[model samples]
Target: MAPSSDAAADGEPSGDVMTYHLKAEHELRIEVDFDRQVTVKLLSGDAEIFGCELPKGGAKTLSGVKCAIFTWHAAQIQIVGKPDACYEAEASAAMRSYLNLHTALEERRKAAVTTTSPTTKGPRVLVVGNTDAGKSTVCKILCSYACRADAMHGGVAAAAGHDHWVPVFVDLDVGQNSVTPPGTICAVPVDAPVDPVDGWPGEAPLVYYFGHASPGENAAHYKALVESMARVLAQRETDDVLARAAGLVVNTMGWTDGLGYDLLLHAISALSIDIVAVIDHDKLTAQLKAHVGSQGGDVQVVKLPKSGGVVTRDTNFRKRARDRMIRSYFYGSRSELNPCASAIDASSFKVFRVGGGARAPNTALPLGATSRMDPLRVAPLPMTRDLERCVLGVLHGDNAALGDADVLSKPCAGIVCVTEVDASRGKVHILQPSPGSLPSKLLLSGTMRWND
Candidate 1:
């Protein structure tokens, strides 16, 4: 309510720091506002003060003024006047608080819709290849480029040519993770990638392991791998890591058979992802197409460089064919959805995170809220010439075998696949399209095998 006499008592308080810098042709105007008489003073790296004071009012700052405040601190702006002479003290504090709050709110708003500025560093690119395909050589080239570019430009271009840049390097390749092998770049595993710059360890990405599964040897380990992969991907997706991935490189083991194909399909299905790019393996590409066709998805094929596909194998010339396949995996249109703008140089085995793998309600089971093991049973279609084709396929496919399955209404096209509980009891299941509602013309029935 009342003014503080102490604050106004001094024209310039002791122990307060201030500084002033003067450039050529600049005027430093310091206004001395006081209810009482006071003197003006400017102290710092040599600054001249010119101004006059009309005695009745106070000393007015004069001409030939040289005042420029660039970036100098510890200087002084002092006022000598009677106690309680400057303007109300409370008003100044209120202005300071308002400005601070306004600035903070503005910053928060900017964060919502900001794109990466190019002045920031670019992401670190790590390239890895299978042993024979010159994995080390690729690393060498990357390092050569990264080091030279960083040296010349001061650092990896932090300028977010797009989004962000992390200045970190880590390695975790089971047993082969080493960038210091002298010729090729070493692999880094999640357990021990590069150390964190500020306060965290390197983050591990899911290895998109694109190789063919080992055959005839579906040992316990294979199952374990599947479970482990599922669990890992689940954790990452839940934690939002999958959402942040830029691009993934999938390295397949040099084989393309049922095991590899199945494993690859299961993995993709598990992630429910549309592949972005293809590596230079023709065998893998064909398998990929088969799976995509089944799922009604589209993908671009990128073949590897033909010139680089030369490698020594079975016969000198035949090995050439193998080399071409390897290069082809690297060929394809850009993965339309690489979270990162750049293609990840690592194999795909590491990037695919487990996504929502929940299966839809079984269409053949007449979905219910309770038990899910029952089969959807509908009566055999009444002999109608138009429905003969549909009836034939179902009968062969075990649609007519069910005593309880009564044809409910208009005969549908074809039953897709079926599941069985007991193999010895001759139990079969028939799958149907996920129709929205039961067709009025057919009486849909469901059957469950009660082996007990």
Candidate 2:
């Protein structure tokens, strides 16, 4: 839903919304003109018809109809010849640029209130996401004078040092809107809490929404939540009373093959410019190889980490990341079943099973995919593949949260999910795609207890 009840459609020229990464794919063009008709000439075995031609005081659209002016909308751009071509291309490209710019602007505007103030030479990091993706741990470990996050969750949210601020939340699951308070985890110091008194938010980091919900879940509600949060954080960056931090460290919600790859991509695009992915060595190397840029024949790709810190009023980044950690620990996963230990990061991307008789890797199959895994079950998708497409609804049922997420491995447009389960212990850990051959079907039943 729109951030405001009064807000109209998302800022884009509406008719059909086609989400494609033009930057990574193709350049669009268009043309228009005021001229007369010459004749209809079909060339190349009548394969390519240049134009139908128009009358002197008339115009022609990209579709080849003659008129003073005409508007054509299609993924394949219209190329008119000569003067008209220049004008059409200019107008079409200009319009699309404005359209995308407007969409980005409007999205930010709706969520502007939630952005936190900035820090010094880096972004005001706001830690968000589901449990165990290292949201709080990362914030606690973040050095640099300007780096801070309000990561503590739960009651009496008081961190000891510069990173003592707490995370805030809005009820976005349907009608829930009450502010989330700190919980048990925030009170217990898994490690020494960052002392907030040591460093005050010199300038608060701007606030931004961080979430772990898969796409098509409650993500859209973030627009409204962000707006609300921005209002409180946009204040002076240094004000310390529950102030927000500058950077947002979004810990993903992954447990036993959840946090689908598509979800990760969406999060990277939405929350972080730099995706510090902790995939296994092979996958990372493959991505590095796939860096198809013209800069000296690829591999110069950079996610572009923010050079300088941000400035905003949200100063309690550490505490917030901590709080989110607590919430996610308690509410997001099958804590009873798996009993998560600690979060993982680049350092611990691989999980080792101590004593189950190990089976060898499955190299007999190929790690290929398709856009649709099972067309019969999947919703009718448009011809194009849009990663942003998601399954809607809270993943609250007794069934596995990953039922839909498994679609990632489909060839044409799939997520690339990697499930890790300790069948011996009836435990599971959904992970990002690790390097290897074809996947071994994680037998959740027959080997694992179906119900808790």
Query: What lDDT would each prediction earn against the true structure?
Result: 0.27, 0.25
RMSD of each: 29.7, 26.4
Which window of ten consecutive residues has the lowest lDDT sum in model 1?
Answer: 344-353
Q: Mind giving the per-residue lDDT tens digits that candidate 1 earns over 327-415?
A: 22122112122111111111110111111122345564554644333222222322222221111111111232333222211222222
What TM-score does prediction 1 earn? 0.27
Root mean square deviation (Cα) for candidate 2 = 26.4
Which model scores highest in lDDT? 1
TM-score of each: 0.27, 0.23
Query: Model 2 shows how many backbone clashes?
Result: 104
lDDT of 2 by residue, 184-255 (tens): 000111122232211112122222222222223333223333333333433432454333332232333332
